[model samples]
Target: MVKQKSLTNDNTTKVEFNNSVQTIDKSICDDVNDTVIANGMHLRHTMLTLNSFRFTTQLLRSLLMGFILLTSLNTKQLAQSSNLFNRNTRPSIECLKNDRFYRDPNRPVHKIWTNIECSKYFLCLDGDVFEFKCSEGLLFDVVRQICDFKQNVDNCDITADDAVNFENFDLYTQILFSPNNRNPNGCPIKGTFFVSHQYTNYQFVQKLWNDGHEISVHSVTHRGPEIWWSKNATIEDWFDEMVGQANILNRFANIRMEDIRGMRVPFLRIGWNRQFLMMKEFGFVYDASMVAPFSNPPLWPYTLDFKMPHTCTGQNCPSRSYPGIWEIVINQLEVGDFTCGMIDSCPSQLNGDDVYRMLSHNFKRHYLSNRAPFGLYFHATWFNNNNYLEAFLRFMDDLQKLSDVYFVTQQQVIQWMRRPKITPHLNTFDPWGCKPRQWESPEVACSIPNTCKLRSRVLQQDRYLYTCNECPTQYPWIRNEFGLD
Candidate 1:
């Protein structure tokens, strides 16, 4: 097995090694299978999807400690069968890994002591709302109740199946929806925010994206792929479907590159063609177009051969939901993007209980494995599920419980997937753009608009993104360091 180590000097480089890390070296995988069978940790029906892992230092340290302690305990009482049973089958557990108490920014870091005696870390299926919890753990649900029994946004109902629930032991997760598209003046908008009504929408997304919650890019109008990707479509259709989106996004979010970070194929077109690779050529980091193993369709990402972020010519990492990018030969689990369907893409038949069950399954899969990224993919239109926004809020509360895991933006993870084999900091600055000159006199490289858009976050800043006359629906970049972008 090959392993990578992150070393920092003048640069950060990932060096591959032979058996340097957690060793499970058997090309045939027969040894691992045998060991699993012998140990009785065999696969169960519920053991399904897996999230991709970064193998962080914490994980490595925990594994090392567990190994060292197991070795010491075993050798300390060698020769006695009773001792072996006592050591390996202790009635207790090992100390937690890199576990830190969550604290408020204004407060002190208080120690959160825990003795996991009866701590059952399981995904709980409430009658209607589901959440993650460890029995006897703190109750950490209801960060903000966005929905009520009426399924209203901020509706104050709290009726029979209205409230979302999660035990205190879990963490709050971030959720962001790549917006849909629109046709303006009979032209498809491109490179802009799809939903262009309110600044609050953009502000919310900006905050979540900054917080490491994912904020992916959907199509400009979210036109079904038939119109967007079809070969039979005319130039107008292409523009309306493709460039239109780019232009709109450019106007809204103002993303300069124009290519969106991720997208779900309209009508699941790519699921049949498996052409998501085509998107990479345009600079998309990844696509959330597929489903996962526990998904309604139930496909395994391990079967896909993809390992990195990709363009049209290359393959990409398999999502936990829909599968097949990974080499069908090699197995690496990928977490798929779950979604909220305010529109018709997926059926909205799941009761609150059903939805909660699905989410519980998502977490349970991660808990069973070494833990990886799980994308709670959805659409802003999902807010339509109920008249009020309580359901979505409830969903958010439940999803946030996996604090130990990272909820990254589509771009961040994709950039990581594009993780270079050479080394980081090679350029010191990104190779894509001009270097900033704070001390040097600022030059007016481009023309500013005569009238800036009302949504410009940069007005408070140095007035950087907004032109005097131009108003981008959203900036080319995400909110700059100060939300000005």
Candidate 2:
């Protein structure tokens, strides 16, 4: 038996075999360099001893074959080590140089990339790179370009066991009632009224908020031809229309800005990426506008970090990614052979039993399958039909009997998406539990609300503003969101 010792330095490895010694330089074997350095010394001694003994040509050939086999094993080990090193290494900030935004300052500044570990992301802005870390238990989603729950990002090292198990058959239901007009007479059964500042009873809106219903923005002017939202609307148009409504709801209805977390595009006319861009910048959590195909397993709400999973059914579906903004798809309801995007658009002629059957049929598709959040999205005008209203109430009553069904607001649904819970544990979920309203001012309550009439330059007529607080000199509209005179 030969005693062997090996020593490694920056550029070479020295090996001593008994009294014989040899040094292997790093440059000779680039692919198998590390392996050679580790075992070359011991193998060198064996070759030398065999050579001195005048070994047969066949024996020497066999010895050479053994050495080749040893090198192959070492090569595999070295390759695995290299891969491990790459995984552990933090990606360089210079990696941003490959992005178009870094190369061209005129390009959009929304460029983002993640480290190999997916624990943090790097944002490129004005040719500079900035690092940001994901929240606890979350990972940087490369597809969506935002920090998200671990289960949503496919490449994450974490297991999906932490997510809510779908086998439990839990169904979350959300009702999104968008009232575009504030008519004093209330929503008409026939047609929508003109958008008004006055008729919306602020006290009633406040009561809804108080009752734990989510107050989401529809639009300040729900103006139409309907094509404007899908075609001519710009990002600024969305900011004014949606954000302006939110401002009015906050000032008059006393709904907190943080609580108003969602928006539905007028007429379900998606403004492509424009509306989503505004939603992301303005802290809105989700958009319940885009329509999905009427499929058996309906589409679930998903983040805009990657391309949309379904085809763009409505006009101008978002083509760009708007990370962190959730898209609650309006999975179409089947009525006979046709499908309607909004539940209200479904045949209103149906009897009470028929209405119940239609809703139950569509709902079971989600309930029996992936258990995606089922939505009942409609305008308040839909309730004007007595049969439709009665059947909807009956449907709600039936759903309440299920131990696993929960009727939640859109904001609450988004919260559940972030941290999902199994049916058994959902009872303790904090987001669903109602708490007392946190009013910014004590004047949020109004025993006698003020009705202010102000001249509007845009409308060229007097506009009404009903509020619990002091009325502004001018009624709030598009650019004049705060109702400043």
Candidate 3:
């Protein structure tokens, strides 16, 4: 006689014949045809009449084959679905070859290009391909080459659900220049200069500060092998590089230490936590070395209280929190197809009209959207190009026509961010308004600026020191910032 065991709650079926029991897990055979289950039942019933062992063996083998076949088919379907998804997401090798930045050979080869969606990017390593996706609400920034806020990624179609809706906000523009070498030509047409001590004209720096343009530190040496700042620089190295320049500025330029509130690292290569720790330890309020992604509603200058909202494309970006020190992001400007971190690096082939259009297009991206501060970072050499200079002037002239657009300094931008006000209140904004220049000492204009030729401790070479104040005994390099021989 044959008897059927009750199915367990787990959906396991048991069939018994002549003191032998065979268990079939319905979970495995759930997708198997109903005929397969019915045939098994019929074999068990026939066992009662025929009482044969061979028939029962055949029934178990047939059921096992069905489970294997169904599992194989399901696995094949899943593989096809996975392949389809990869085909859609992965960028073609041809696409990478065509990318101007990718083909340049100057950029890092590993993270060369982004997929069309901008939500993911491809990594090429040793003939193998790997893919990475940004976190939720972020997109790949092709310019800065990092995962950034959705609004900051150009060509990214991803919608930011949590984006702050800024309405009727006035546009504030900040122009910053990091002048590494000294020239008789004082300030450029517009913008503040973050002067390095190497070849800087202290008198000219003082004049710029007095003229109400911001004077921030670049570095004492501004030494090259630019990668050193991001890779090998220790906390002490940053202090000497930045604070050393501040000392020189204060002693020679007569600019107060307290007034030198900002700095831009040489080559925009940040030293991650070491850099920020140095800034926080000292009194520096901001650093403008970090680059923001190119987006319509651009990223605003932000403090380091929380984890960075954008990707750290600077390589060794800070992992820990730095509460008060602000990051004045170098929001990139979009040119024809590519983007540039600094205005000068944009297409030099562009005519005056092309330059104007490029500037206007990038400016409107900020003006029409969240009104984050539009930054035009440049070096003094950029203005040497007549085309760029003319176009830039035209662009600024057009911007001046707008009642709401205000050209402020980096310090003023931070102040506004601290106590934000609407467009109506901007005209009367105290921070944006200039304060009277309170000189600590009588202004001493060296009729004949003292030009001292001193031997550099680090470079071990004769360096020219130009300043309104008395020249140092030795060339002020990194470690010997005071130039005390």
Candidate 4:
């Protein structure tokens, strides 16, 4: 047996062997039979042997030529099949050597990102680029470079069946409130607060904690040039912001440090892989700062195993996988008639009615979609406006009337996603409704007294000084740093 090698159109070389053992046996048998018959007879066998030998020789030659032609045809067929397979099955960008460019030629090589929508691939071979489209209804996703459905492009390893369970009959809503500045009264009028250190009043934060509202850290400074600051911040910086915030609350506010489970970047500017690594190291469960408009029904809480399907709208988005760290994406909001991702960026001049309409529209987007948890992500600034405040309060009141809706925290929503169960009714879900709890101090007196004002001479002070307005007259027990009576 002899092996033959052939190159296919796809630039792959395949090895084949000549399988003509039967042909060779038949040729040898015919020659031996002709020789034996010639030996049995003398005179007549001599001439007959000559004719027989000639016929046998010609037959062997013909068989040899036929086998050669057969081998050639088989080689050609194998090559053709290889080419067909290469063409029909989409090859990833990896098939093309040094091919960094996507479909667009204008964008820089580094800037062009692959998504689930990639259906075609350009093979850069031999100093020429050849384009190959994926087989019908599939797109060539740049991240993975394989042809897949648009919905499956995120590469989260989620199945279509995982999108929604009609039998479940429930949906979720989570509030991720970024408290950019502290409230003077220390009590959040609405939603959970991501308190900044500048205005942090532990007593008020404790009230929020006791009320079952989530308390997440939003850096100490909540500094300017948000993206640059977050992107450049290190693990030490995050520790000071989050762990430090926890320490302040524990020492003064009496809030447990272990209770803080999540965090959001100050400006939704992801700190890339480093931030997630920091979260995983510090025992944090999730981060809700990511914006994912590319996701259709919005992505559920997924670990950092594969490339996220959503567009990385914010700076320094995570590029590598960080196991066990979950991302609670910020779904875009549907403003009155227009859709916007950020609440602050929603169409301006929206009165209370328009705000209510926008919230309703956004609520439906999640309700009708995969039932992924909807997020009401906003800063406290939005609530400062009377119209916006009234509209939000009204919306919540209206939302509570609906049986399926749940206004929970990010941590609570993620808990359900991890251990999901189908129920006949929405109320059956745990953490759906709240029960009353005892407060350390009465709600009316949650804030410090009017006579005692918060004063901090330095920026890095851990606790605020409760300075007596009328010196020794008010708060007679309190003393200054110098211990003056």
Candidate 5:
């Protein structure tokens, strides 16, 4: 029988056949047939071993190629991951350029800067400098450069702007009540009272504050020749009256000093330059003494950077600019076709029906036009009469009946003016409109099982008309004070 041996070279396998005595042919069929016949198992074993080695060599080659490809992939993944980490961990840069351009280097922030031209302001918010554009119809007043009513801007076509769509907007209303009267017995009165040295019902003011009603300063001493609020008063005089009033409210009414953001001139007569300067210095955000809406459609609240908009009907409107201080103009109440700011200034005394018509008409003006804020400006004396009181109540109830109508405070109105929510995208704006509030119950304030005798009377002392009343003094309802016998 022949014996066979296998040899391996660097790249190939070779098979040799031989006998015990002499070499034979390399073909297994010729030289190894005897071995296959005599020792079949050995021949079978050699053949099987050769086949297994060949298969194993092919598998190892495949595995080596796979390992090289996997290593290349892992290195690329590591490099890509390093780049991603660097991008996410890098420092942010804030660049403040030019006099009008600024960037906050430590954080992502935007800022507004005033330019040398009063009418042209620059905003550096989105890493770019851009001029502010007013809403349709308004023009930039060069004196102060803020968007203002067209009447104040010379050579501008007021008629060229597109009208605001009321269908897409919500009606915003604010009631401005100047606490000019003091309660006689340190109790909240039901009717009209002026700020006197006699007494202040801190409880009433507290209720107003808690109920979301804005209580603004008229004057600490609301006593008037009406001339004190004219241009004749100095800045010191205006400060003593306006700021003094705020101090009194904060001290006595538990109202935050910063919360009092609005004021009205005594008798609706502005102290002009001095009053505005004092307001800016005293942290007051807006003033409600101006009466320009009588001649034009109501305008949104604007800063006093330019001349007063509309006709400066009140005495000595400020000629100088008070930047950043807002003028909350009193949009006139419409009585039939005529328009007036003061409730009493209407042609004649309005009954409940006239009052309702007047208010509804005035509201339509704002609801129809640019959707400017609607104001119901009045002294407590006007509401003292049952005719006006019931009418005012009806007006308020009617307002509450309408959808998307909010009877908010003046400060709230100013906030909306600054950031208008007129777009259809803001369908949920002013969510607090007529929401039920936890106010003191009428029975608690007025009726307490005969322990308190609620009475109201109209008393005229000198030229002023006021309503006087007596109550339990603990929980008194100022409105119900006069209605009771």
Candidate 6:
């Protein structure tokens, strides 16, 4: 929303500007150091929140595309003249201020947030997301959590105030890139997107979709049962929420709506079979409303799914009650509704920050592990114009930086699940080498040939190990890749 002027002159060429994007500061780049550093701390977290994702700046041109070398800033925003031995550490206080991502060496500031890669950082440009060049703050946040640090800010040789800046000693988890680089066409990537979904940033949604992020419908109206979810929810509500959501989403970017491909229950609340019925009506490829009893998502400490393992035998697997719908249960393995708090009917009215931490933990963990889609249950009210919403979005923006986790709709996951449901041939090293938990087949579908359905059941392995009979091959899928085999 902020505006800035393009300081680049007529002679400024992309080649020339690209050459100068590496420097952190110049004489003119002053004014907002603290803001830049703090922001950078948050931005750094975004870049490295989830270690499972590996971001590559591949130009997805029609033909054989050339690679674009994206430049990010050094983790240390400020040049520590005295703290040369700090090594990879930067002052938290200063680094948290006016730091930039994908910032130009010549120009060191992000005028606005946007999806545009930092071709050149000029004091004049503008956008929302600065750039995903590197991850510094990410290391700080994740490491601080799992690791134990006791530097004693003031108690040490340095004063308490010095601890915020001179502190070092880090790293809890590091990124491990998967071997698969030839991702599918619908894979996740950063780009400007535009879409037309209900009460959503249609343009933002569309941009995210076009830019390779998963675009989906949150709800038809994004309202509760009385207004949009009720048995008597009206055509108007449908127009405002359901149809409107689809229309906006369909119009999202220039992409065809036929591949928009995802949906979730508006309020994470659905009637008996209402969600399934709606998934059909909405033409979604998958529905993520199936948060059954167990879900082995890759993330933890917030939402964890621990269920008793079952068995998936020959034809007697999990039964499928509906067509093209997978029941995605939010397994609160770390902590969820039962512990911290579940965003129920009045989630939007909630006034707690713990909700975000809980949600973010799952997202970060899943991203790091390249695990399955994280089922985030939130109500429309969660995005209301309130402090809660502001904090939530900020937290989300940081989460986005953590990893290239696909922000898919339930439909998309369902579609992926529907694609040739083959179990990974069990290998000796496959988690204690135990057989996959079997699904419960329906009485009617017994030995029915092609119609053999897979029922929902989580067969537990040993202590801390479990997989779904329905999706055993890839017990946890990330970036469309499964680890089951």
Task: Return the top candidate by lDDT.
Answer: 3
Candidate 2 lDDT over 73-167, as tens digits, reads: 23323222111101112334444543221111122222211332455444342344534444455555444444455544533332211111121
Roughly what TM-score does model 2 have, to 2 decimal places? 0.58
Taken over the whole model, the C-alpha lDDT of each candidate is 0.30, 0.58, 0.61, 0.50, 0.47, 0.31
Instruction: Tell me the spans in candidate 5 whose CA falls farther than 4 Å from its real position.
Output: 1-198, 336-338, 423-485
lDDT of 1 by residue, 416-443 (tens): 3445322233233132112432321111
Candidate 5 residues 1-485, lDDT tens each? 12334334333223221111222223432333343334433432443333233223232222211211122122323222211100111234332343221112232212111221212223232243333333344444433323444444431221211111111101111222223211222111121112321124444454445544566776644433467568467887777666776665554455677668888775678886788788888888988878774644677778888766676754688888888888888777767667777776786656778877787778888978877877766544465466776777676666655555654567776666667775442334442233444543331222111223222121100111111123332221122221233
Estimate the TM-score for candidate 1. Answer: 0.34
Off by over 4 Å in 3: 1-190, 442-448
Candidate 4 Cα outliers beyond 4 Å, as residue runs: 1-191, 336-339, 423-429, 433-485
- Weakest 10 consecutive residues, lDDT, candidate 2? 160-169
Measured against the true structure, the TM-scores of the candidates, in listed sequence, are: 0.34, 0.58, 0.60, 0.52, 0.48, 0.32
- Tens-digit per-residue lDDT, 1-485, candidate 3: 23445475867756443344667654444433333444544532332323222233344433422222122122323222211112113344323322111221222323323333455554332232334444555555444544555444433322211111111001112232223211122222234567766546566666566656677888765654478789898889898889988888787777777789999987788888899999999989999989866666789989999877788764678889999999998888888788899877777788888888988998988888888889988765565567777787677767656767776789988988889888777766776654465665535445466788886544323556666788789888677777898
Q: Which scores greater on TM-score, model 1 or model 3?
A: 3
Determine which window of 10 residues in candidate 5 has minimal summed lDDT.
160-169
Candidate closer to the true structure by lDDT (higher is better), 1 or 5: 5
Locate the minimum summed-lDDT window of 10 residues in model 6: 168-177
Shift of residue 436 alpha carbon in model 1, Å = 16
Which ranges in model 1 have alpha carbons more than 4 Å from their true place?
1-217, 224-240, 258-260, 271-280, 292-349, 370-372, 385-395, 398-403, 415-485
Error of 5 at 37 (Å): 99
Give the best candidate by TM-score. Answer: 3
Q: Is candidate 3 or candidate 5 better by TM-score?
A: 3
- Candidate 4 lDDT by residue in tens digits, 56-105: 43333333222222221223332222111122222433333443323423
